[model samples]
Target: MANDFPFFKKQSNNWVYTLLLLPLWLVLYLNLQIIADFLIDDLLQLQNGNHLTEALRFFIFETPKVLLLLILIIFLVGIIRSYFTPEKTRKILGNKSLFTGNILASLLGIVTPFCSCSAIPLFLGFVEAGIPLGVTFSFLIAAPMINEVALVLLIGLFGWKVAIIYIGTGLLIAIFAGWILGKLKLERYVADWVYKVQIGQSEEEEKLKFSERIGGGYAAVKEIVGKIWIYILIGIAVGAGAHGYVPEDYLGTLLGRGNWYGVPLAILIGIPMYSNAAGIIPIVSVLIEKGVSLGTALAFMMSVIALSLPEVIILKKVLKWPLIAFFIGIVTSGILVVGFLFNVIM
Candidate 1:
């Protein structure tokens, strides 16, 4: 009866079935806090003020909360993404000039269906499609760094103002970083084989029906949720531990605006790590709660999601050492500026 099934989708009953599921989902989501409270306070009867009990309750509450939010958003994003394929994205970026291309590509990166894990292929796709190198870089940076999962978590946890700041600064970073990398004219630095393997554009999405789009959404939930659900649990667990136990003074002294080195140091620590926004945002919230500055926490989150060691290693498959370094350097510089600027402003 699910919308993802093509046969059910072909029938008029598909929408009705989907509508039935909606209220059930709403009930679960709306009463999540109540349910978590029931398990901890009523069922288990754990002592309220105890650190371990509090941590357990935090984890129990946040794990399902984050996952439910992620599933719904990712599913919706997937349906929206069905309209924008790699081929379609390439065509849109193709023939666009430098500045315009970077803007368009960065915006497109949000709706396009690719992640850090698929960076190399997306880069190659853009390259073979004759998109500008800088523009391609823009898409690469924005696609993972300012992704939906991160954006949603930010909005849910930090409110609209912070979410807007994140999006604006993230877009700026992507746009300008790609622009800087483009000005360097580093096309020659790409691996030689990338140039040799020219690919023709395939006409895949001339049209899609509504049910097909719904199926696309279902597939997205399966693929992205399956990959990141464990990370969400792990991240929330780490966050819960911090929320219950980490001393305020340490986080404040280490990442407070008073600490000039906080932003850069946070980035440095984050670059070696690997976690998506879904995994890292909980930690971000904990940092902010524990007295860390938003800018430093954001810098840490950005570095992990956007410039991780693994992503850089993957880029090495296509980019020579110099280009990879420049990519890192330019993006890091942007993140640093954003961190420092925001620390002063907010």
Candidate 2:
């Protein structure tokens, strides 16, 4: 059906249609809040300060907003990833010093935003391309944990300070933890299937024409957004529930900064609850407003997005239990340290 649409097909004239349609997407995205407000305030006849009304408004407003952001980010990221194929990544990082490769790979994670499930192919590709385990780990960690959407949302919802802190710590965690894993030389633990698989070489890299990149972007929106939209809806639903009825004082008592156990407890709780950063930010905001400590809240948020149980289960396809356990331990410890340090200093 998509191929039957002239603009959707890969064509020389695709950029023209892409440019023409972007404004329409933007206009609709910008008006979502108004629509949410109308439904909550006028149609539902809900009071402004009421928690139930606020939660419903948030759910209504954020669901579409997050989906739109995911589409836009995924499309752009797909175009970028088109340039950085597994072969290309291997060629570039394959020969570099391990430390340097880990750093570069972690930085690339910001732009190449593959989620947990989507990351497995890249992980396998990296291994097949002869990319080092440590470097592969860096990319894997960074891709989902510190992607552009998460960073942008953090900055928008919190201040630049919070966003910067998250980015810096996330990078550090990916790099050093990958470095540690690299030093451990745990190659024997990787699933045999990953080592056995091979990918064919691709054609030479030429600059894709503008239209081709646009088509690639369109394909990305379809593929990536289609897979994760349901997760986004579910995450937002969970966030809305927390926003609407969770007692603020109870949250503060449990996860507040002064509580020494808050960080680890938050981490433990967050691991079981899966969410993307977009879906979790609304709940984070409410948690902070309710007096949960910033560090603890951040630890909870990161654990939910980056180290969720679902991601661990998905990774089990390639990583054996020991390596997976190690990866989790190192990351969890790093997050705990970050949480404690931030709570003390900030």
Candidate 3:
């Protein structure tokens, strides 16, 4: 009966699946927005109060909402990713020219929720599945940089325009960086030890059923939330402090357009940090409010998200120093360009 609909018949099964998921996605998005709104409103009220106890109360209240949103969103993304067989991904990526493959791979990366540590295993999986080094690099860069959690947080905090720019710029960086790296023939720069490890048995046959996928998504939410709870707390705490106490004039003076060093300093400051998208965005919001240039703040956020110390450390296990350095250089330049662009435009 459903197939009788002309529109449904015209669209492929993948599009059908996407349509089916739309309602769930919308519900989750609305829930997250409501939670964020509640937090902001409550925090504002606390700020209005002169009592010293208000700060502690705001912290205690807002933490749970943030954690809950993170867990729910992460779990949903994980469950969806669980269904994506490496073989299927390879098939889509295979036979395509380098340019097309890099673009596809970077777009695909936006849907995955892999962290820096998880990227190595998945990177190996992509290689084993016969995906090209450059295409795989595109995926690796995208997965951590433009994830669901980050996208949702950005949309919730900054509206769709900024979110779209962030996503678009991130993909551009990944695609071009991967393509350039691939042209350099840097595969030899992968560590010798990585090659020594035997490829494991394929798990494609063990694909989860829909119910199982849902369960796995739930578990993923719990696991990720547990691991990153501290980072979220610390990041938000700093943001909240800055929101309440940072001097706007001083921030404007330092990070203003006249200060050419502000952008580079923001980039440098972001490199060593180990915060996720959800955690860093609130901080970015605070910085922008305190007079940080949008481009500088965005560059800082991208640097932190795309090239963290831990991410680089994890990549070292799979990549040689030369390749890793090249990756960093490409992405850093991309971030800087994006920063300057936003500064000029916004």
Candidate 4:
């Protein structure tokens, strides 16, 4: 009797699967946008009034909505990711042509939602698996730079155009930087201890069942949401304030559209900060609206994603100084190129 359902039938191809999923994805996207819009607009309306009650009301309503949306999305992505066993990923990467592996790793990185803080463990795992340093760097660069959180937030606030550019440029940077580093033969810079890890066993052997995946997703939501709630609130509040209050002329003068140094300054400023991709995205949107060059703002964002001081510190455990510095230099140049191209084109 269940076979009568045409939609459930597997044909010669899975095109129908995508056709079915696309509508579901669209619905989710729309629902998310509606919630974001309602929260932001209502808060703005209340702020127009000059009363403590209204101010408190605004805070009470908007903050929770933003946080809820973020957590829900993270859990959903985690659930999707749980289906992707790392052993399957390793098989794909095992072919290991430098160019192909770099591209594949960078693309894989975008969908894997680990932040810079979690990157060290993942990096160690990749090294122990005998993945090349450059390919691993591609994963490292792409992970934080093209996070699902940032992509969703961008689509919610700025629409798909900005989001596409952000995602595309990030992958390009990761790919090129990884390839360049591979060509440079920078493997010798790995901490000597990394070479000694036994490779027969991999973390991917711990497979979660469907029930476990759901449970893991819930745990991921709780852990990630709990930790970043304050940061998200503060970051969004600062972005909102800037949105309402910052003078465009002031921003223009500081990060003028055509200024060559603007991109470099953005990267430099972002390097010392310890924000994740999600935290910095709202700020990037605000900066763009306030007349900062697209290149400059994006470069800043990429730097925060790839070169945060804390991330570097964590990498120190696995990499010698020279290797770390080389990684930084290569990725920074990639970001600069991306920044310049977008500024010129868009």
lDDT by residue (tens digit), candidate 3, 82-196: 7665456666887767789999988878765455656778877777666788988888888778987676666544567888999999999999999998889888998877656
Cα lDDT of all candidates, in order?
0.84, 0.80, 0.74, 0.72
Tell me which of candidates 3 and 4 scores higher on lDDT. 3
After superposing candidate 2 on the true structure, give the runs of residues whose Cα lies further than 4 Å from its correct spot. Answer: 1-6, 21-72, 113-115, 118-121, 159-161, 191-207, 222-247, 278-286, 310-321
**Candidate 1 residue pairs in clash (backbone atoms < 3 Å):** none
* Counted clashes in each candidate structure: 0, 0, 0, 0
Candidate 2, residues 1-346, lDDT tens digits: the string is 2365665765777767778778988998999989999998899889998878887888898788777766777778767877766556667777767899899888877765465656787887788877889988988888778865676556545658998999999999899888888889999999988888867766777877766776787877776567656656765666676664545598798888789999999899998899776667767877777778989988888888778788888889889999998888988998999889988998
Clashing pairs in 4: none
Model 1, range 220-300, lDDT digits (tens) per residue? Answer: 777778777776676677777876454668878989989999999999999999887777887787788788899999998
lDDT of 3 at 31: 70
> lDDT for model 4, on a 0 to 1 scale?
0.72
Q: Is candidate 3 or candidate 4 better by TM-score?
A: 4
Stretches > 4 Å off in candidate 3? 1-72, 85-91, 193-197, 225-246
TM-score of each: 0.86, 0.75, 0.73, 0.75
All-Cα superposition RMSD per candidate: 3.2, 4.4, 8.2, 7.7
Q: Could you give the candidate ranking by lDDT, starting with the highest?
A: 1, 2, 3, 4
**Local lDDT at 156 for model 2:** 48
In terms of lDDT, which candidate is stronger, 1 or 2? 1
